[model samples]
Structures are given as C-alpha cells and as structure tokens.
Target: MRKILIITGNYGEGHKQAANALYKVIQLRQLNYEPIIIDFMEVTHPLLNPISHYIFINGIKMFPSIYGFFYRKTRAANSMSEILNKINNLGVSRLLKTIKEVEPSVIVSTFPLAAGAVSRLKEHGYIDVPTVTVITDHTYHSSWIHDNTDRYIISSEYVKEDLQSLGVPKEKIAVTGIPIRPEFCHNLSVDPLRTKHGINPSIPVVLIMGGGVGIIGDGSTTIRALENLPKKVQIIVVCGYNDKLKKQLSRELSNSKHEVILLGHVDYIHELMAISDMLITKPGGLTTSEAVASELPMLLFKPLPGQEQDNAKLLTDLGVAFQAKNTKEMIEVLSFSLFTPEILNKMRGNAKKIHRKWAAFEALDVIDEVQNATSSHGTPMEMNS
Candidate 1:
C-alpha cells in the first residue's frame, strides 16, 4: 500500500487537528493508501520538544503582545523571517531519514516548521516527493510559504489573495477550507442533539470554546457577561484541559439564572456545536471552521494578536461572524444577535455559502492530483511502488 506521511506539531491544537482530519478521511475513504501521522517535534527533538512546547504554550498566554509582535514582524518574507525559516530547518536530516523510511507517495505538512523542513529537503534536491502544505489558519503568514512546496491548501479566497500578494502563484494554491473532523461536516438534527444534551430546545443555545488552553477571558467574566444577557439563553462552556478554569467557573456559575453547562475537555464538541445557535469562540482556525460547517453563527471574543486576529477578520469579513473586543462588546453582540434572529439566519446562510464541510476529502483530491502530476513527470518513484 502507498503511504502518505502527514507531519504535524503539538505547539498548538490546530496543526495537530488539521493533520488528524486529513488522516481520518484518508483512513475512511482511501483503502489503497495508508496514512501515517507523526508529530514532527517529537521525532526531531525528543528531549527539548516538551520543554519548548511548554514555553510556547505559556509564552502565548503570559505575553501575547510579544507573540503578536513576532507574528506581525514575520508576516512577510523579509530577511528576518527568512532567517527564522532557515532556523526551522534544524531537523532536515532526521526528517529526510523518516522520509526515506516511510517512502510516502506524497508528503503533507500541517505545521509550518515541518513544511519548512520538507521544503528545504526538496529545495536541496534531497527528496523528489510532492509536498502539500495545509495552512491551518486563514491569515497570510510568510512562514507557511516555501519555494519548493508543490501546493498550498488554504482556508478561503481571502487567503488565496493574501498568498498571491506574497508572490505565490495562484494556481499553486487550493482554497480548501481548513480540514475539520468528518463529524462536523455533516448536518445533524438540532432538536435531537439538544434533547440528548438535556438542553432546552425553546431557548437559544450559545456554545463557548476557548481552544485547548481556555484563553477566552479573565476567569468567569465572559460567562457572567453572557448570563446577564437580557434574553435568557443556555450557555455551554467547553473549558478544554484547563482544570483550574473549569473549577472556578463551576463554583461561580453554580447558581446562574440561565442554564450553564460547564464541561472540561470533550470529544463531543461537534455535537455541542450542532445544538447551538451561536458560537462564542477564540476564532482559532479549526474551531471557526467547525462552526461554519455546523452553520452556527459566531461572536468571536477578543482575539489574541496574530492568527487569531486574522482569523477573526476573515470570518467577520465573510459576514458569518462578529468580533467583540471585550466582555462589554461580547454582551452587546450577544444581545443584538439574540434580539435579531434574522441576522443569525443570514449569517448561517453566508456560512453555508463558504463552508467546505468535506474539506478533508477535497484536500485528498488535491493530494491525488499532485501525486498524479508528479508521476506523469517520471521524476521520483513509481505509482504502484
């Protein structure tokens, strides 16, 4: 069986999630191909990976300004960003070894660092395998671009234009909405999901997600603000992996006027999303993509600088979501949406227009196209090797 090596990282969940989405679709549909998913950092830097990952997660939380500063500085392919991209090429030798071991028909990268590494390999004429970079965010960051990458799987036409402005050929980019889990791609009956979750079908259900680190806002400020909305609504807060935040919210919202369901990390986020009318999230690429897939309108919280901000801009520009700078703005947006159901319906319509529910399948088709085109050139290996 032919293999597809999917490289991802754990610095953030989006990268890993995007990679997993592709792996899942390939497993479910492509019987002739085997999908191999590997955490690039783990294989490349086994010892320092964990420490660096810890620093990365905390660095964004403790000093978002600093992170945003760097993110902005590196948005374009300047000398500084190029130098950083070269620094990201640290594990090329190990990566090349893995490439040889796996002998994947095509290589896919969901993490920019891994993309840089693979691009370096192809640049230096070490590997002839076709490479596809699935950008996990809607923003145009120079880090995700490389001279040797054969194709770019991007989120939308906005991202396509952003990349084209950076000098990447438009033909080289495919606007496949960021790959989300297959479950979110399908339409489920909302009444059944609401009943299953014991949610009131009569009131609006707002699903709140802060990504895995729970970076929504200070403790329960956002929740309290939501509870105080003039219209009574059911709030489902998914505090992913943040035990402290979960416990704090549990204590604080125990007696909320509106029904508040507080949960820790959950695997059934798609189900929760299906039942909700609106999503208040951090605007991470994966979460927003899932929301769009569910046709759920969104009120993005004060997004951190960098990709979160960029993602927020894209969603709002597309008319599928609203951005709130703080709790006050959050309340305002929530109240307005609650009072105006038509606006929510319009947003859902916009979401339907752009949402690529089968993005993973579409990405697989791109991979197949690239592989076939490469085979036609007779450069690397045989198709049935």
Candidate 2:
C-alpha cells in the first residue's frame, strides 16, 4: 500500500481534525493508500510538545485578544514572516529524517509549521514527495505560503483569489473547501437523530460547540437569552474535550428553563448537527464546514480576532450565519430570528448553497493524480488529468 504522510500539530484541534478527516476518507475509499497521521511537534520536539501545547491552550483561552493580535499582525506580512518561518524550519532535519523512515509516497500538511518544514525539505533538495497543505483557517496567512509546495487545498474560491493576488499560480491552488470528517458528508434524518439522542423530535433544536477545546465557556447567558425568546428551543452544548467546563455547565444548567443537554468530548457531531436548527459557537474552519455540510444555520459567538473573525465575516457574507459580538447582541439576534420560520429557512438555504461536502474526496483525487504523475527519482510530478 502507498503511504500518505499527514503532518499536523495540536495547537488547535482544527489541524488534527482536518488530518483525521482525510485519513478517514482514505480508509473508507479503500484507495490502496495508507494514511499516516503524525503530530509534527511530537516528532520534532517530543519533550517540549506537551508543554508548548499547554502554554498555547492556556494563553489563548485566558487571553484570546492577545493571541488574535499576533495572528492579525503576522497574517499578511509575508516578508516579515521570514524569521518565524526560519525558526519553524529549524526542525526540517528531524522532519526529513521521519520522511525517510515513513517513506511516504505523498506528504500532506494540515499545520502551517509542518508545511514550512516540508517545504524547506523540498527546497534544500532533501525530498520531493508530493507536498500539499490544507490551510485550516478561513483567512490566508503568510505562514502557509512556501516555495516547492505542489498543491494547496483551500477553503473557498475567494481564498484562491487571495492566494493568486499573493502571486501563487492559479494552477498551484485548488478549492476543495476544507476537508471534514466523512461522517459529516452523509445525509441523515434529523427526526431519527433527535429520537436517538432522546431529544424532543417536534421542537426546534439548537446545537452549540466551542471548538475542540470548548472555547464557548459556561454559555449560561446564551442559554438564558435563548430561553427569553418566546419560541421553545432545545439546546445541546458539546463541550469538546473540556471536562471542567462540561461539569460546570452541567451543574449550572441543571435547572435551565430551556431543555439543555450538556455533553463532553463527543465523536458524533454529525448527528448533533443533523438535528440542530442553529449552531451557536465559535467559527472554527472545520466546525463551520461541517455545519455547512449538515445544512445547519449558525449563530457565531464573538469570534477571536484571527481566522475565526475571518470565518464569521465569510459566513455572514454568505448569509448562512449570524454573529453576536457580546451577550446582548447574541440574545438580540436569536430573538429577532428564532421564531421566524422564513428566516431560518433562508439561513439553511444559504448554508446549502456553499456546502462543499465532498471536499475530502476532491482533495484525494488531486493527491492521487499527483502521486501517479510523480517520478521514481523523487522529482516534481506533472499533474495527471
């Protein structure tokens, strides 16, 4: 079996989520491809990986504005990103060593740092595997740009145009949306999912997510706001991988006026989305794409200032999502549209209009073409049609 190396990191779960989605696609398609997903940080700096991840998680969680500030400052500064890229590329030697060991026929990067290291490998003439980067955010960043990258799988056509403006050849970029779990691509009836989860099938459902690490906090006020609406709604909050938040939310919402189901670290987000009328959450790329695939309208909470802000703008622009900058605005938006079937219908329609459910399969097709055209001597491959 040919191996496809997927290099990712744990900065946020978005990169890892993208990697897992592509891996699942390879598995289900049974395409004679072995998808090897590796945490680049673990391979490059094992001892420091966990510590660094802790710092990042806490830093962003405690002070998102600070994180967003840096994200904005460096987002478009390609020339100014050189030092940062060089520091990331310092792990190129270790990464290249892993490449030799894995002997992958193709290399795909879901993390920008991993992409940097792999691109450095190709530029230094150390490796030539078909290299692809699945940009995990809605916005383009200089960290994702690198020479020697064969193809870039991006979120949307607008992002493609932006990359083109940055001088990346049109042929070098492909708009496959963002790869999401294959389960999210399936069509399932909401009534059945509601029954399975023991939720009332007749009532309109609201699903809330805080990204993978549960960035949504207690969300007590959001629930109170929802309850204030005249319409009766059932709310399910998925507190991903955040046990403390889950416990706190559960205790706090034990007597919530609106029916509330607070959960922790669930693998079945597809089912949740299938039943939800509107998803109130932070707009991470993977989650938003999954929501789109499920044709669920969104109520994005105050997004952090980086790619999330970008994601919110794009979704709101497409009319699939509504944004709330704070508690008051969140309640107001829900109150305005929550009881209106016509408005909700419009949101769902807009979601379907931009839903790219087959992004993983499309990306796989490109990767297959790249691999088939590649030379045995590890040289660049002309894309085979």
Candidate 3:
C-alpha cells in the first residue's frame, strides 16, 4: 500500500479531526493506501511542543482579543505574515527527516504550518511527492497559501475564490467541503439514539460542545442561561477531554431541574448530533460541518475572533445557524427558537441544503486522483504555476 502522510497539529481539534476523517475514509473504503497521522509540532519540536500547546490553548482563553488581533492582522499576505509563515516553518528539517523515513507517496496537510513547511521543502526540491493542503476553516489565511502545493482542498467555493484572489491558481483548488467523519454521512435513527442515551425522544435535545479544548466561553454561565429558558429541554454537554470542566459542571448542574447529561471526550458525537434538535456550540469547522451533515440547526455561542467568527458569519448567512453574542442573547434565542418548532425546522432544512455528507469521499477521490496522476508521470508532482 502506498503511504499517505497526513500532517496535522493539535492547536485546535479541527485540524486533527480533518486528518482523522481522511484517515477513516481511506480505511473504510478499503483503499490500497496507508494513512499515517503525525502531530507536526510534537514530532518536530518535542520539548517545546507541550509548552507551546499549553500557551496556545490558554492564550485563546485568557487573551482572546490579543489572539484575534494577530489572527486578523495576519489574514492577508503581507510581509509580516510572510515572515511569520517562514518562522512557522521551523520544523522543515525534522519534517524532511520524517518524509525520508515514511517514504509517503503523497503528503496531506490539515494544519497551515505543516502545509507551509511541506511547500518550502518541495520548493527547494527536497521532496517531490504531491502535496494536498486541506483548509480546515471557512476562512482563508495567508499561511495556508503555498506556491508549491499541488492541490488545495477547501470547504466551499467562497474559499476557492478567496484563494484565487490571493493568487492561487483556480485549477489547483478543489471545493470538496471540509471533510468530516464517514459516520456522519449516514442517517442514524434519532429515537433509538435518544433512548439509548437515556434522553426522552419527545423533548427537544440541545447538544453543546466546546470544541476540543473544552473552552466554551464559560460553560457554567451558558448552562445557567439555558436553564433560564421556560421550555423544558434535554441538554447534553460534551466537555471534550476537559476533566476539570466536566467535574465542575457536574457539581454545578447536579440539582438542575432539567435532565442534563455530561460527557467527556466522547467518540459518539455523530450519535449525539443525530438525536439533537439543535446544537449550541462554538463554530469550529469540523464540528459545524458535522452538525450540518447531521442536519442539526445550530445556536452558535460566542465564537472566537478569527476563523470561528468567519464560520459563524457564513453559517448564519446560510440560514442554518444563529449566533448568540452573550448570555442574554443566548437565553432569548434559545427560548424563542426552542418553543417554536418552525424556527428550528427552518434552520434544519437550511442545514440539509448545504450539508456535504459525502465530503470525505470527495476528498478521498482527490487523493486518489493526485496519487494516480503522479504515479503515471513517474515523478513528483510539480507546481506548474
């Protein structure tokens, strides 16, 4: 089997999730391809990886405005952003070593820095394998644009245009939607899942996720706001590997009037999404894509400044999502929407309209095509533009 090296980072879960989705689709389809995922930072900067990871996670939580400022300032291809991308290409030597050891037929990057590093290596003629960069967010950043990248897999045509405006050739872009888990492609029976999870099928099920890092902009505050709703709803919160938050929520919501189920790092988000009448979560690319795939309308809560804000705006414009600016707006939106079935149904219908349920398969097709074309040429794919 030809190896497909999937390079990702853990700064946020969307990159890793996108990588895992590609890996799963390859395995599920029984393709004659071996998918290997590596945390580029972990492998390249082993000692500093943990420290950097902590700062990235906490930095967003502690100082979101600062993070947002940099994120916004670096969106365009300016000299400062160029320097930062080059600086971000710190692990190029280590990445080259990894490529030598893995001998992959193609390199797929879900993280922007990883894509930049691979593009740098390919530009210098260090490696010839085809490179596919999957943009995990609805927005485009200069870091994700690399001259030597063979293909750009993006979530939508809007992003394709964004890249085109940034000078990336149109032929090098593929609008495959953001690849999501294969399980989300199929429609699961909601009633069974609700019963299995000890939830009432009759009541509205609101699924809340804080993304991978469990930073949901004050989970306790959000829950209290939800509890204030006059309607009775079943709330399911997926803490996502945050033990401290889970334990704290457990204590806080123990005496809640409504049934609230708390979970930590569940592998069954598809199931939860299946049974959910609506999702109250941060608008990360992967989670929102999964929610869209599940045909679940979303009440996006306090999206961070950057890709998330872009995602929230896109979803809202698409009519599949509503944003809650703060605790008061969240309460008002949930109360108004939950009590009215037509509102939620309209959003759900809108979600179904844009859902790319087969995005993973589409991405796999791109991977297969790139590998086959390169193999037929008997050379590493080079950027003609």
Candidate 4:
C-alpha cells in the first residue's frame, strides 16, 4: 500500500482543519493508500512546541506591532527561506531518522513549518518523496513557498496570480478553493436545520464565530451592533473554549428581545452554518470556505493583520462578503443587508459562484496525480530554490 504523510501545525486552527479535511477525503476514497497525519511541531523538537505556540498566539495578541515587524522581515526576498532551512537542518539527524522509518511515498504539508522541514530533508538527500503544499490561506506569503515543493494547492484564482507574481510557475499551482469538511458540501434544507437548532424559521439567524480561540476582543461590540438592529434577529454566538465570553454574552443579552444562544466549542458547526442566514466573523481561510459552502454571506469584522486582511480583501472583491471596521459601521451594514433581500440574494449567488462543490474530491485527485508521477518516474522531483 502507498503511504502519504499529511503534516500540519497547531499555531492556528486553519492548517490543522485543512489537513483534517484532506485526510477525510483521502480516507473515504479508499484508494489502497494509507494516510498518516502528524503535527510537525509535535514531532520535531518537543522543546520548541510550547515556545512556538506562545510566540504565535500571545505575540499576535500582546505585541502585534512586534509580530508585524517579524512578519514583514520574514517576507523579504529569501530571509524566511534561509531561517527555515537552518532550523530544518538543525534537527536533520532526528528528522531523517524518522522519515527513514515512516517511508512515505508522498508528503503533503498544510503548514509552512512542514513544508520547510520536508524541503530540508529532500535537499539533504534523505527522502525522495513528492512534496505538495496546501496553502491554508487565501493569500501566498514567501514563507509558504519552498524550493523543494512539487505543487501548490491554493484557495482562489487571485492567489494563483499572487504566486505567479512571486515567480512560482503557473503549472505548479492549482486553485482548489479551500479544503473544508465534506459535511459543508452536503445539502441540508435550512428549515430542517433551523428546527434542529431550535431557531425560528421566520426570523433570520446570524452566526457569530471568533474562530477556534472562541473570543475576539470585538465580540461585545459586534453583539451591541446586532442588538441595535430594528428587526429581532436570532444570534448564535459560538465562543470557542472561552467560557467567560459565553457567560458575558449570555448575561449581556439576557433580557433583550432578540434571542441570543451562547455556546462554547460546538462540534456541529455544519448544522449551525446550514441554519444561519449570515456570518459575522474574522476571515480565516477555513471558516470563510465553510461559510461559502453553506451559501452564507459574511460581514468580516476587524481581521487580524497579514493573511486575514488579504482574505478579507479577496472576499470583498468577489462580492461574497463585506468588511466592517467598527461597531457602528458593522450595524449599518447588517441592518442594510438584513432589510434588503436583493443584497442578501446577490451575496449568496456570488458565494455559490466561487464555491467549489467538490474541493475535497479535487484535492484527492491531486494526491492521485502525485502518486502517478511518483510511480511512473521513480525519480525525485526538485523544486528550484
């Protein structure tokens, strides 16, 4: 049986979520292949995991200016590439030893760290596997591209242009939408989903998500804006892993005329998406893809700097979502959107236009291509540095 290694990191939920979606698709195809999923951070240098996570999460939260400085520095010509190569080579002996044992025919990376690690292994002649990168964001950064990757799976056609501008060959990139769970593609009637969630079918339902972290600092502001709307709307606020935020939202909206359902870490996001009329979220790639698949329009609020900002622009350009910089603007946008059926319908239509109904299946097809290329050539492919 052929083996494919799917590598991701826990720095953010998008990479892991994208990796999991690809894993499920490959497994369901039953293609006489074994798929192994690994968190690269966990496997490579355990001592660095906590430090890396802290630097990523808290660095963004507490010191965004510093984070932006580092982010910008890393994007300079070959700066990030050199840094990653050095780190990958630092643990070469251990990493090579691990790869020797696992013997994967193909390597798929959802995180930049994995791509860098695999590139190092290939450069050192330790592994001959075909390497493919599924960029877990709508935009491409220099860090995401490595010299040793064979192909790139990206989210939008616009990203294809971005990669092209960065000197990546057009042939090496495929716009596969963003890989989301197959459940998002499943057809669930809105009425049934509303009934299941105990939501009123007559009133429009809005889903407010702050990604996996559960709470964005702007949650209160967003809630207040929604509360100001003239129409009584049902709001389902998912505060992922943040109990304090859940309680706060519940307490704040307790006596309001609008129905506010406060939840913490729910598994059935697809059901919620199915029932929701629209989404108010920060534009992480995976969440955006899921929203599109559910045919739910979005009002993106206060995207964190870097990739999210890029994602927001792409969604806005596609006419699938709106960006609101502050609470008052957010409320005005929502009020106008909710009251105008044509606007909502147009946004939904645009979302469907860009939606890849078979993203998971298409990703599996790319895996098959890699497998065919590996089998027929029996030679390791090289990516230009």
Candidate that scores best on lDDT: 3
lDDT of 3 by residue, 1-385 (tens): 7999999999999999999999999999998899999999987788899999999999898898998999899898788898897677675677788787888988999999899888888887778889899999888998898889999999998898889998888989999999999999999987778779998877888889998868898777777677787878899999998899899889989888788999999889999999888899999999999999998989899988998999999999999999998988988888888878899889889988889999989998998888887863224333322
**Which ranges in model 1 have alpha carbons more than 4 Å from their true place?**
376-385
For all candidates in order, the CA lDDT equals 0.86, 0.84, 0.88, 0.81
Cα lDDT tens digits for candidate 2, 53-158: 9999888768989988888778875555777886776556667778888889989999999988888778767887888899987779888988888999999999
Per-residue alpha-carbon lDDT of model 1 for 12-115, expressed as tens digits?
88998999899899988955889999999998788889999889988887899999999999888898898897677665677777777888889999999898
lDDT of 2: 0.84
Provide TM-scores for the models: 0.94, 0.94, 0.96, 0.92
Q: Name the candidate, 1 or 4, with the larger TM-score value.
A: 1
Better by lDDT, candidate 3 or 2: 3
Task: Compose the digit string of candidate 4's lDDT tens values, residues 8-67.
Answer: 888888898898898888888888778888888777767888898877786776766676
The list of candidate 3 runs beyond 4 A from truth reads 376-385
Model 2's TM-score against the true structure: 0.94
If both were scored by lDDT, which would come out higher, candidate 1 or candidate 2?
1
